[model samples]
Target: MDGQICCMVMRVNLDCNSCCRKMRRNILNMKEIEKHLIEKQQNRVSVCGRFKPADVAIKLRKKMNRRVEILEIEELPVHYEAEQEAPIVNHYKYY
Candidate 1:
């Protein structure tokens, strides 16, 4: 990957169960997202992947048609592991 692996947290208006479900579906459909967590109580969503934070925010805004506020963005450390005859693998720890 060219860009750094990172985790982005955003505050969104998740009002009901349907809203949460919609958000989950959207996040799951995004190919660039490796993992995601939706905190309905906090009205926040955390997404981890190799992507530009701004780009993700824009995408969410357009897809959700709701206000999206970026709360935090942090770069994650990449760990490499390899087995005896296997290719190297990249791993990321999501916080």
Candidate 2:
């Protein structure tokens, strides 16, 4: 398994009530032990009741036939970037 996990976001057309119900039930039944493990190391005691964006992506793919968009992706600690400090402006220099 690759260390990098893809985080996908999708907007789908779910037109039927039955499909919605099944999707909800399916989501509830699905479990990700690896995500729980990651959270456990980060001082997160309970994996339940937490937002699972990746799981949502899976559900969307299962229910809809549209293409999913990949948005706001970030790798682990190595790729993190801090905000740059604002530049100091001198009004006298422009005049």
Candidate 3:
């Protein structure tokens, strides 16, 4: 029972139009993870939802022709509107 976890995480800072570009870049990083696969050790890849579109995982698995483990997908919250910060007032209250 080896407790070591061997995996690669691809993190992308998302903006408006960068989603598509990040996805393509993340796909290429999969090959980098594959390079770490040696002997009996297992190498895995982790990608966020923004990096993966529909059916991308399926395509990656078929392309790699190897077993890929999908971990739990976490859903993040969306904040529609945020309140503006109040003006900062500095004073010696206890003076």
Candidates 1 and 3 compared: the better one by TM-score is 1
What's model 2's TM-score? 0.31
- Per-residue C-alpha lDDT of model 3 across residues 1-55, encoded as one tens digit per residue: 0122233342223333444344455566653232221112223345433333224
- The most accurate candidate by lDDT is 1
Given candidate 2, what's the lDDT at residue 84?
26
Q: Counting only residues 3 or more apart in sequence or on different chains, how many pairs clash (N, Cα, C under 3 Å) in candidate 1?
A: 0
How displaced is residue 21 in candidate 3, in Å? Answer: 18
lDDT of 1 by residue, 1-95 (tens): 43667889999999999999999988888888988999999999999888888888898899999999999998865552123237766797879
Which residue pairs clash within candidate 1? none
Q: TM-scores of the models, in the given order? A: 0.78, 0.31, 0.34
Which candidate number would show the highest TM-score if scored against the true structure?
1
Candidate 2 lDDT, tens digit per residue, 3-45?
3333322334445665455544554565532232112122211
Q: Could you give me the TM-score of model 1 versus the true structure? A: 0.78
Candidate 3 residue 32 Cα shift, in angstroms, is 18
Ranked by TM-score, the better of candidates 2 and 3 is 3
